[model samples]
Target: MTPISSKGRTRGGLAALICGALAAGGLAAAGTTALTPQAAHASSHREAPLISGTPQYDNTDLYAFVSPDRPDTTTIVADWIPFEEPAGGPNFYPFAEDAQYDLHIDNNGDAHGELLFRYTFKTHVRNKHTFLYNTGPVDSLDDPDLNVTQTYDIELIRLKNQHVMSKTKIADDVPVAPSNVGKASMPDYGKLRDQAVHQLPNGAVTFAGQADDPFFLDLRVFDLLYGGNLSEVGNDTLKGYNVNSIALQVPTHLLTESAHQPVVGIWSTTQRRTAHGSYAQVSRLGNPLVNEVVNPQKDKDTFNASSPWQDARFLKNVTNPELPRLIESIYKIKAPAEPRNDLVDVFLKGVPGLNQPPHVTPAEELRLNTSVKPSMHPKRLGVLDGDTAGFPNGRRLTDDVVDAALQVVEGELVGSKNDLGDAVDANDKEFGHTFPYLAEPTEGSRGPLAKGTSGGTDVRSQLGDALQPAGESRNTTLIAASAASGAAGVLLIGTGLAWWRRRVRRPY
Candidate 1:
C-alpha cells in the first residue's frame, strides 16, 4: 500500500495522496460526502437556496489550524454573513440574535462532535427610534453613540450519543465588536477590535465582530458552471466584502481526547429559530466549495440539514465527480475515471499520518493533526507544494484552498495538472498573524483617519505578495488586489513547481 506520505507534497503528484488512501479503503471510514471540485473557490457561501435567502444564518467559511502565532493553541474561525457592503447604513451586520452558531470537533473520529462550541447572541437597541447606527463618533466599543449593540454567550459542551453530556458557558454577555462604519464613527477600529476580545476562565480567547472577509476567490466561475469558459479577468469577487466572524482560540488539550490521537475533524453550522420556536439548521460547512460545487441543485439544502453520519448517500458524488469532466469539456483533456479514489482520500478520510485521525470513520471535515508544528514559512499551495502545515493538514487563513482544491480535483496525483485557477490569489486586507487573524473590516462611515490608509489602502495588505512563483523553499501567488474602498492591497504567490500551462480553447 502506498503510504499516504507527503510524497505528492514534494512533487506535483497529489493524486497519490488519494491513491494511497484508496488502497487502504480510506473512504470506507464513513459519513463522507461528495464535494464540489474544480468548480468554485469559496467554501460555503449561500450554497443552498434557503441559505441564499438567509445570510445571517449562512456559514460562509470555516478555518481550523495550529495557531501560527501561538502553536500551543489552535484557532478555529467561522465566518457568517457574506459580501457585506461596509457603507450599508442604518443596520450594519450583526450576529442574528435568534440564531445559534456552533463549531464541532470529531477528534475521536465518530463523525460526531465530541465537543461543541456554541455561540448565541442578543442585540440591544440602546437608542430606540434612532436612524443612525451611531449618534456620534464612537470612540470605543462601549461608546454610548453606538445605538445598536450585541452581546453573546459562549458555551463548551461535551456530547455523548448525540446528546449534551455537559455544557459550560465559557463566557457570558461578552460584547460584540461594533461594525466599522467608517472613520467618522470609529476613530480607532483596532481599539474596538481589541476591546471585543474576551478571555474565558478555561483559557480560551474569543471574538465576534464585523471583520473584512478573508475568503479569497474568483467567484465568477459559477457563471458558466459546466457550459462556458472562465473569463480571463474574473477578478476576485469577494474583495471588499465584509462578514460577521466568530473566532475562538483554545489550548490544544481542550480540542483533542489524548495525545495519541491528535488529529481532529472540524465543521461549522448555523441554526435559526423557526416560528414553532424550535431551532433548525440552515447551513453547514467543513471543506471549501463542498456545498457550492458538490451537491446538485436539488440536494444542496438536503445536504445542509444532513449529518455526517448520513453522508454515505453523498459518497457517489465524490467517487464520481463531474468537476474534472467539466474542466475537460473546455480543455479537451482526458478526465479521471469513475471512483476518483484520490478525492475520496483527500476530502473524506484525509491524508493518513497527516490530518487523518487514527480511527476515523470517514466524514466530510477539515481535519488537522494537532501534533504538526506551525510552519515558519508556509506554502499557500499546501500539500501540493510540500508544506506540512498548510491546508488538508488543517487550513490557515493564508492557505490557498482554492488553488489546492482545483489541482486535487483535476487528479494531480495521477499526473493530471489541469492548471485550473480563478487567478484571484490573495486577500484584500492584511491578516493579523495573531488571534482573530482576519484583517479589520473596511471603513464605512469614517471617523478618525485609521492607520495604513495610503489612498485608502492598508500598509499590510494580504494580497501584497500573491501570484508569484512558489519558491523552491517558499511559494507565493498574487490572488487579489486591494478593494477599491477598503484596503486596496495586492498579493503574489503561485502553486508549487509550476509546469507549462496549456490554455485550451477559450470558452468565453
Candidate 2:
C-alpha cells in the first residue's frame, strides 16, 4: 500500500461545481428523516437524532492515530456536541461508567472484520450532596457539611479470536478529584485546568473532565443558504464557545497488530437504558451526532437501534465503494474518474490514492496508517491539507472537515485540475495546545471581552480599529515617510508638500 501524503489544496473552479452538485443534490434532500449520498459520507455532525438532546453521548466525531507527542503510543479523541461550554459548572460532566467505548481494527481491509479493544466506564458516585452553598463565611476545620465528593471507574478490554479479556483498570471510584481539592477548598481556575491531567502507567495518560468545545463555524450562513432560514441557530452561533471533552493517550504498541503492520481502524459506541426497563438491554450503540445523514424524527429510535448492530446491511449502502455509481445514477451527474476509483481502491486495499488496486477488506471503520510517522507540526486542515491524521485515518477535534469533504467530492486529491469553489476561511479558531486539548474559558458575564473601566465609551471603537488584517501596521505610513529623511528635512518636506497641494487645488 502506498502511504498517502497530506499536502494538496483543492483546485478552485471544478471544486465549486462539485460543491454545487453536492449542495443541490446531496443536501437538498437532507432533513430529520432522509439523507442524500453527498451528506452520507461526509464527516459525522448532527447525524443522529438520539444525541440531539444528550450532547455528552452524541459522539459527533472520533479520531485515532500514532501520538505526535509520543510516537510509541496511539491517541484517540472522541468529540460530542459541537460547541459545549468548557466551564459551565457547579455541575461538571463525566463519562458514563455503564457505557461501552470501543476502538475497532480491520487488518483484513474488509469493512466487517475483527474487534480489537474496548473500554467500559463504571461510575461510582458517593455522598451525593444537592447544594454547594453555605450561609456562614467561615466553617469548622472538619466540617462534613461543606460539600459532597464524587468518583468513577474505567475498565479496559482486549479481544482476540472473538474471545474477550480484561486488560486493566485505569481508575476506580478514585475521588472525583476536584481541580483544586486542597487549595482553599474553593474552585480555582488555574488549579482546575492543571489537575485535569491523569497519568497512566507505561507513559500513557488520560484526562477526563469538562473543557471548552473547540469547534467554531458560522452555521447560520449554511442554514440560510440551504434551510431557508436561520431561526433554529440557537446557541449554535460560533462567535466564541466551547464543549466538555474526554481525551486519552495510550502507547501505540498496545493498539497495533504488530510494528511491521501498523494500520488499524477505529470507531466509538454509547449504550443507554431503553424503555424496556432492562439494564441488560443495551438500547443504543454507534457513534452518534455524526454521519450528517438526515433521519426523520419518527426514525430516531430506528437510527439508534440500527447503528451499531446493522452495519453490514444499512451502513454499507453509503460506506460501500460500489455506492458511488448508485450516487451517480440517483443524482444524474457524471462521477469523476479518479475519486470513484480512489474510493473503490482505498476501500479495498487501504492505499492512499487510487494509485494502486485495493488489497484490503471493506470495513466501515476509520483506518490509520501507523507506518506514517506522527506529525510534530500537525495541521487541522484534514485530507485537503495532506494530513493523514485528519479524516480517512481518524477524525480529530479541530479538523476543518467540511472543507475536506468538499475537496473529495470535487476530485481535488486525484490530481484533477478542477477547483471546488467551496472557498471559505480556513483559519477559524481551534482548541488549545495541551492536555484536555481545549482552551480555558474566559470568566465574568462579558464573555470573550470584558467591560471597560473609567466609563470609556469609545473603547469598543478603538479596539475595533486596532484589529486590522496582517501586514498593515498602524505606524507603517509614518515610518515610511520619515525614515529616509533627516528630522528637519522631514518637517520641511511635509510643509512644502502641504503648501504645494493647497496652492494647486485652491478654488479648482
Candidate 3:
C-alpha cells in the first residue's frame, strides 16, 4: 500500500485523499445523522428492474487508472454484489459459476472491445457432510479442512480491426482467498488478502475475492433529493459493507493498437451462459452513477442489457439530460442550455483535450489516458479544480467524484460554479495507493466499528461559507462568496416542502 503523504491537491483535496486512505485502512467516521442508504454512487447496483433480481452478477462499480507505482501498467477493478453485509455466514458470496465475467477494452473508440479478459469461477466442496465453511482454523488458502473452495480461470482474447487474432490462457485453476469470517475462523485476514493476489499466466497481476466496499456516499440524498444540510455529511452507509472485487494489473500495450493514441475505453460486463452455448449480457458498468441516477426507470433495464455501441438510442438522455433539469427546478438555478454538448463531451465522448482519442466514435465508457502519470496528490473534485490526473479521465479510488459529478452537472467545467453538495467529501474507509487498492472487508466477527467527525469541514462547505453570511441583518443570510449555495439551501427546503404537500402521490 502506498504511504499517505502530503499531496498538495485542490482546496479540500488533501483531506478527501486522507479519507480514502482511512477507508482503505478500515477506519470510520461518525456523525450526528444516521448512515442513510448510499444515494450517490456509480454503475448499476440493482438499478435495473431485471438485474436487481441477480445481485451476484450485477456490476456495482468499475474503476480504472494508471498504476501509480508502475507507470508502464494500468489497473482495472470491477466490483459486484452491492451492500454485502460482512456477517453473511454459511453461504457467503461467490462469483456465479454459470456467469461469464469480462473486462472490455476499446482502444480505437469504436465502442467494441479490442481486447477482452474473461473469468469463470468453479466451486468445490471437499466435505459435503460438514456444515461449517471450515472444519477448523484456516491458516492457509490450501487448508485441507476448508470445506468449500472457489477457483477460476483467466482467458485473454485480442481483436485487431474487429477480428480475433489471438487467444491465450493466463492462468487456470487459481484458488480464491477465503472470506474473513471472524477472529476464530480466520485470525489473520491480511494473509488471506495477500495470498489472493496471484501472478497471471501472462505476467499480469490479479486478485478476486471479498473486499471492503470502497464506494462512499451520504445516502441522505434519498428522503428528499435536496433536504439535508451540507454542514456535516451523514454516516457512510457502505462503511460496514463488502463487495466481490476483480482487480487486474495489465500492460498498456495489450489494450492499445498504436502508440500515437494513448487513450483507451474500459467497461465491465456479466454474462450468463445460455442453452445455446453463447453468453447473454446481464449487467454492465463503465462510468459511476450512470444507471443509478442518470437514466430513467423505463430505460434502465435496457441500458444494462445493451452494449456501449448500442448507446445511441439513449443519446437523447445525455444531450438534454433530466438530472440537470431536476437540479435547475429544485435548486432554482439556471442550468446549461439544451443540446448540452458540454455534458455529451464529458459523459459520452471523453473530453477532447484530456482523454478523447484521435479517431473514435462517441460512446459511453470510462476513458483513461494511460500517458498521464498517476498523481500522488490527486484531487477529489477532478478536472473541475484543475486536477487533470483524476476522474472524468479515469476514476481513482481517492477521487471525490460525487462532488465532481455534481459540479459537472451544474456546468462547472464550462465555468459555471455551484458548490452545493452532500457534505460527504471523503469515503468512510481508506484507499491504498497501489495494486488492489481497496481496503480489507469488514470481518464477520468484526468488533464494533468506531466513528469520528475529527476531520475538518469539506471544501465545498467552506467555499460556500468563505464569505461569512453578510453582517447586515436580513430575513435570509446571503452568502456572497457562493451565491449559488445560498439559493441552493432555499431550493432544497422548498423541494422537500413540496414533496410533503404532494404526499398523496408517489414521488419518482
Which candidate's lDDT is highest? 1
TM-score of 3: 0.78
Q: 1 or 2: which has the higher TM-score?
A: 1
lDDT digits (tens) for residues 1-508 of candidate 3: 0111224534443223323433453221111011221111237667789889989999998989888888788899999998788778898888899998999899888677889999989999998886788888888888886778899998898976558989988879887876678777888887878888998744589999998988887655554454522333445656788999999999877777677788999999889988998888888888988887787888787777777766766666666778777766655668877665566667666765678776556667899988888886776777656677788788888776676777667665454645645656677778776678888888887643312243332334334323335774221222332244444664455455455757846766
**Span of ten consecutive residues with least summed lDDT in model 3:** 30-39
Q: Which candidate tops TM-score?
A: 1
Error of 3 at 505 (Å): 65
Against the hidden true structure, what lDDT does model 3 obtain?
0.73
- Which runs in model 3 stand beyond 4 Å of their true positions? 1-42, 160-163, 226-233, 275-277, 447-508
Q: Rank the candidates by TM-score, best first.
A: 1, 3, 2
- Regions of model 1 farther than 4 Å from truth: 1-9, 12-17, 23-42, 225-230, 445-508
TM-score of 2: 0.62
Write candidate 1's Cα lDDT for 122-171 as tens digits.
99988688788899988877789889899999888999757989998788
Better of 1 and 2 by lDDT: 1
Model 1 residue 375 CA deviation (Å) reads 1.0
The global C-alpha lDDT for each of the candidates, from Candidate 1 onward, is 0.75, 0.44, 0.73
Cα deviation at 4, candidate 3, in Å, is 24
